[model samples]
Target: MKSSYFTTLIQLLLLGAKNPIKLSTSDLAISIDKTQQTASMHLLFLEKNNMIARYKIDGDDVIQISASGLKYLLSVNQKIQSAFDDNSSTLVTGKVFSGLGEGAYYISLSGYKKQFISKLGYEPYPGTLNLKLSSNLHKQFIENLSNVDGIIIEGFTDKKRTYGNVICYPSIIDSNIQGSVILIERTHHDSSVVELISPTFLRKKLKLKDGDEVKVNISV
Candidate 1:
C-alpha cells in the first residue's frame, strides 16, 4: 500500500482502533485531521487492501488492525531504525600527528573563525589535531567522507590570498570530547590525514601526543 494509507492506519491504531474496538468515522476524522468522508474512504481502502478488518458488534462499527497491517508497520519501523543506525555514528581510527603549523595560522583567521563559530556552534582553538589513519580501510573511509557534502564553511579572500572552503563533519573524540573532522579545499595533507578542530586544545585535553591512537566518532 501507499505510505499515506499506512499513515492513516497508524493514526487509527493510535486512536485505540485495534483488537476489534469500537471506532466511528467521525472520531477517526478528528483524530486524522480529515473530514468524515475522507476518513470513511480511508477505512474502505484499508479494508479492501486487507490491512484492516471492519465489522459490527451488536450493531456498532468495530475496527481492528489485521496481522498483515501489523507486519507492515513492523517492517517500516525496522527499516527506519536501520537507517538511523547507519547514519548516527561512524568510527574512524587513527594516530595523532603534528601538522606543518599551517593549521594554527589559517584557523586563527577572522574570516574562517567567525563562520566556524556560527555554523559549528563553537569557536575553534587556534590549531587543529592531525590524525594519520591506522590502516588502508580507515583511509578509504576518510576518502569516502571527503566526497560527501558536509557542514560548509565558505571561503573568503583577503589582501594576501583567497582561502578555499572547508567541509566539516561533527565528531566526538574518544567518545567524550566534541570536535569536527574538517576537509579543506586546499591542503598539504592527503585523504589519509584527517584534520580535526575543536573548542579546546585536543592534544592537551586528551593528553595525546604523536603516535597516540585515537578514535573519532563522526556523525554523518
Candidate 2:
C-alpha cells in the first residue's frame, strides 16, 4: 500500500474515532488538511476497498472506517514504529524449558533447513531450544519485535504439506553464543515461549537445564 493511502486512512480513523457518528467529507478534509474533493476521492477509494463505509444521513454524505480499516491503520503504525527500531538491540531474560518435540520435526524438514543454512550461514541443530520469558518487560519486547519486519525464511511446499514462513532476528545468548531468535509462523507454543536454533547444542554448551535463567540479546 502507498504511504499516502495509509496517511489518509489514519487521518480518517482518528476523526471517526472521536465520535460514534460518521464524519462529513468537508470535516474529514479539514481534519486531514486536504481539499474536500481530494478527501472525497480518498474516502471513495477506501469505501470501494471495504476499508470504510459511506452512507447518507440527514441527506448528507458521511463516512466511518470499518474494522478492516482499523486493522490496516494499526499495521501502518507498526511499520512506522519499526522504521525507528532499526539497529537497536533488546535484552530479554527467559527460563529454559523442554519443547513438545515439534520443533525438531519442522527444523529437520529439508525445505526449512536448507534456507536456514543458506540465510543464517549455518546448518542449525535439528531441534530448537525453547525458553519461557521470565519477566513482563521481556514479554513486551516480544510484542514489539513481532510488529517489525525480521529476516524472513521463505516457506516452500513439499509433497506432504506446505510449510509456513519463519522470522529470525540475530541474537546473542547468555552474552556468549551467537544465534537467532527463530519465530515459526505455525507453532503450537504460546507467545511467552521463544525458540532458538544454533549450530551448537545450546543445552550442553551453556550448561542449561529446565528453570535455568538465560539472557538473549536480540537485534532489532
Candidate 3:
C-alpha cells in the first residue's frame, strides 16, 4: 500500500488505544514492507501533534495511535490486509549451515535436513535436546562403544552441502579410542547433526567417548 494508506492503517489499529503493541521503527517498516525512514517519519509527525504519544518500557519505545489518527486511517484497507498476511517467512530472513568433523562436537542450525523428517507446521526450533561424549582414551574406542543403546552416526555435511541419513553410531565406526569411552546419541535424526543445539556441544566439551569401561556415579 502507499505510504499515506499504510500509515493510516497503523493509525486505525492504534487509534484511541490505551497501551498499544510495543514496536520499533524497524518493526513498523517490516510489518508494512515500507522503508524504515518512511515509517519513522510518519510516526514522528503523528507524535509531534499529540495524535500519538510515545512511551518507554524495558528499554523500548512504544506508541499509542490517537483517536484522531484513527479517523484519518479508517479509509485505508489494502495496507491493513498486507500487514496481517505476513508470516514467519518474513520475520527471520537469515538461516545458518553447519557440519561435524573428527574428534569434535558442536551444535549448529545450518542445513535443511530437519525439514525432511518433521511434520508440516512443526517448528523445529526451541527444542532442547543433545548428545554427550567424554574420554581421554585414544585406542580401543570401537570395542568400548558396544554397550551404548540406540547410538547412531552419520556424516553431517558433505563437500557438496549434502548429508547422509542418520544411522546407529555402532553401525559405523570411524575409529575408536583406547583410553576413553565415546558416548553417542548420533542415532537420533538430529541428535548428532552438527552441534545444532547447546546440549550436544556441551557433550563434546565433556570429552566422553561412546562407551568406555569406567566407574559410574549418579547424584542429584
Best by TM-score: 1
Output the lDDT of residue 82, model 2: 94
**lDDT of every predicted structure (CA atoms):** 0.90, 0.83, 0.40
Q: Find the candidate with the highest lDDT and give its number.
A: 1
What's the TM-score of every candidate structure? 0.67, 0.60, 0.28
lDDT per residue for candidate 1 within 35-107, as digits (tens), equals 9998999999999988899999899899999998888878988999998998677889889988889999999
Q: Tell me how many clashing residue pairs each candidate has.
A: 0, 0, 32
Return the candidate ranking by TM-score, descending: 1, 2, 3
Instruction: Output the better candidate (1/2) by lDDT.
Output: 1
The candidate with the higher lDDT, 1 or 3, is 1
RMSD of 3: 20.2
Q: In model 3, where is the ten-residue run with the lowest total lDDT? A: 87-96
**Stretches of candidate 3 exceeding 4 Å from the true structure:** 1-18, 71-220
Runs in model 2 deviating more than 4 A are 1-87
Error of 1 at 10 (Å): 17
